[model samples]
Target: MIKKPPFVVLSKISDQIARLETEVAVASPTLANVYNDLQCQIDVVVANLEPLQTISGHIEIVERSMETILDFLSSSGDKSISAANVYSLLEPLHAKIHQQGEQLRKIV
Candidate 1:
């Protein structure tokens, strides 16, 4: 068995390193473009989510207002309560409004 000198082994290793470097360098631009595309997609996703978040917040505010109104009406005793029930009249409306608002929010 023959052992190679240290300098010869080092030279071979350097050649292999150079070849690898060249391969990576050649592919670098394509890799960079792919990275940029992924970044753009992420940006688009984040940008799209903003409007939905805003709409959800707005819907929450409206729901809270409706709840407050319902509470206020319940607290205030009505003289003509026998004719029409407040909960029956308003509960459906609040549910409908909340449902529609939620749908709209999702569309955003």
Candidate 2:
């Protein structure tokens, strides 16, 4: 089986995160606290990854993060979603992505 390039995977993950952000914004404007920081972090990761020519080394981390985010979104349609809850759910992933970006910077 052929694999996609890292940039394509990152782009798709970025798109998914953006879509989720928009849905959260519209569905729960009051939960801006939940998604605003996440959006910012994601923006930073995308920006860092966008110009890279050597992200293949970090694709696994990126893909795992994408899966975590997708799973959270899928199982969170209930009204139990709170600012703190979402924040906690996404914080580890955000940190991981942020760290990955830093690593990429050092490598480039």
Candidate 3:
């Protein structure tokens, strides 16, 4: 049996560790850089969620207003309310309410 000098064994082990680090870095490069990239991605996600938050707030208002509209439409027989009255009331709310509704549906 033969015993190699301590430095030779230590040098081989050190080289192997360096090679492992280099191979791993081929994808991510470094731990700090990878962490920074993750933080950046999270920032983007949070920024994107801002509009959803706004819509959630707006949806509350729409839901309340819609309950009123639904009540008005639901009340009485067919001939009781005039179509003209409903049209005039709904005309201004048409575009925004529809667009907001589509966005709201996507969230739900």
Q: Which is the winner by lDDT between candidate 1 and candidate 2?
A: 2
Runs in model 3 with CA error above 4 Å?
1-29, 77-79, 101-108
Task: Tell me the whole-model lDDT of each prediction, alpha carbons only.
Answer: 0.62, 0.71, 0.65
Candidate 3 residue-wise lDDT, 1-100, digit = tens: 6796444444455455555656666676685465455545555555556567677677677777777887878875475777898887676567667787
Candidate 1 lDDT for residue 10:
46
lDDT of 1: 0.62
Q: Please report how far candidate 3 places residue 49 from its true position, in Å.
A: 0.8
Per-residue lDDT over 14-98 for candidate 2, one digit per residue giving the tens place of the 0 to 100 score: 6776777788887787675566676677677767666565455465777787788779888778746677977876787778778
**Candidate 1 residue lDDT tens string, 3-107:** 974445544555554555556557796765555555455555555655555666666776787787668777777645643566765666678667757767676
Pairs of colliding residues, candidate 1: none
Candidate 1: where is the Cα deviation over 4 Å? 1-27, 81-108
- lDDT ranking, best first: 2, 3, 1
Each candidate structure's TM-score, on Cα atoms with residue i matched to residue i, is 0.50, 0.39, 0.55
